[model samples]
Target: MLVAQSSDVSTDLGVYLPLVVMFVVAAAFAVGSALLGPLVGPSRYNRAKLSAYECGIEPSPQPVVGGGRVPVAYYLTAMLFILFDIEMVFLYPFAVSADVLGLFGLVEIFLFIATVGFAYAYVWRRGGLDWN
Candidate 1:
């Protein structure tokens, strides 16, 4: 019994050895890259290099209006994107495994879709999708 347990422990360790090694290598590489970047990279700083870049558009020194406050529309659009993106992320795995999950999964997914659809409808009704 003791020998059997010892062998099983050794077998488990053997199975996990490659995974452990991979994590160690990944950590070492990330640390090495971070430490080497500043030493190897250019030290020179100029106006162009230091200036905030916005897809080739020059950043305004001050807000054109409203004391530099950003529009709520931008945040609303971002939240909507995140909501739908998370919905898709949940959907993909279920779609791939739908056949194995059977009727219960179908019902659950319908419920999930319905919930998201209600949110979408609410947003549409409130003119969240309107550009202006």
Candidate 2:
């Protein structure tokens, strides 16, 4: 009937028409703001402001050969820190799901801890942990 056809058209338009309108409005606003900013902003360029700033340390003169080489141990320590940090992050989700996962979760977490511990011990034995 006419009523049924009218209801169907209204239902479809109600869902999709608002979404289309919102998308168009948001896109227009974003583009308008971006384009308007440069026009209204001040245009002043100076040497001090233009120079690369590094937290008020004053940019150091770069050596021709990338300055002196850094120690490998510093990099190794950073890598180890990142690895353990990631492991800790993964543990949180496992801990939250522990109840649902039951003893399997416990076994898996314990195995993970043991593996990480073994790696740490090996590194310690190899003097990777030593600062000197």
Candidate 3:
């Protein structure tokens, strides 16, 4: 009985292998640079270096919790902006694949838009969008 040699052995480096090797090399370089940096760089440490500097000005003393009371409207506006921004991010992928998704995708997106629009309307009615 003769043994047959495997013919499926790959002679070429796979597409993924190059990516793996690239990542490995990048990691090695990063680690090596980080290790070498402290050894070769200056070892200066002083009181001035330890102090916190704020935009070419001295740091001001303030309460640990916060400096006086601030308006809640500012935070509400920022939160609403972030909420809509994240909704946009979710919709982008669906928009890009609209052609492949066909009518079903259209229905899904319409439902999503309606839900988000209702939320927006509710916020508007509750005065969450108001600046003052």
Candidate 4:
């Protein structure tokens, strides 16, 4: 049993080694691009290039003085979509293995759908489904 456990650990580590290497390479590439951009990029500095413009019109020279707040409804809608999408992703795998999982799987899937439905109802009641 001890020997088998050690072998499993070693095998798992081998399986994960490629994943670690891929992550390291991706990180290195991103960091290299960020670092090398300014170093190798253009050295010109001009007002036209640096100034912020909107729709080809120069913005107001005078800065506006006002408090600003973002709408939470947009974020709530996005989060709800992501939550439901992930639930569907889990459902597909369970469906493929339904025969093997049998009665236990059916009960679990029903419970999952019920929970998601409750959340959907709550969001609907809170007006997340409304597009103002």
Tell me the whole-model lDDT of each prediction, alpha carbons only.
0.92, 0.87, 0.86, 0.88
List residue ranges in candidate 2 displaced over 4 A.
1-62
TM-score of each: 0.69, 0.54, 0.55, 0.52
Worst 10 residues of 1 by lDDT: 62-71
Off by over 4 Å in 4: 1-16, 36-66, 85-100
C-alpha lDDT of candidate 1 relative to the true structure: 0.92
Top candidate on TM-score is: 1
Residue-level lDDT for 91 in candidate 3: 100
Per-residue lDDT of model 1, residues 1-132, tens digit only: 436688788988899999999999999999999999999999999998999877655698874675456679999999999999999999999999999999999999999999999999999999999998
The reply for model 1, stretches above 4 Å from the true place, is: 1-4, 39-44, 52-67
Write candidate 2's Cα lDDT for 38-90 as tens digits: 99888898988888876566676774377456779889999989988999998
Candidate 2 weakest lDDT stretch, 10 residues: 60-69
lDDT per residue for candidate 3 within 74-118, as digits (tens), equals: 788999999999999989999899999999999999999999999
Residue 32, model 3: lDDT of 97
Ranking by TM-score: 1, 3, 2, 4
Error of 1 at 56 (Å): 8.6
lDDT, residue 64, candidate 1: 64
The worst-scoring run of ten residues by lDDT in candidate 4 lies at 62-71
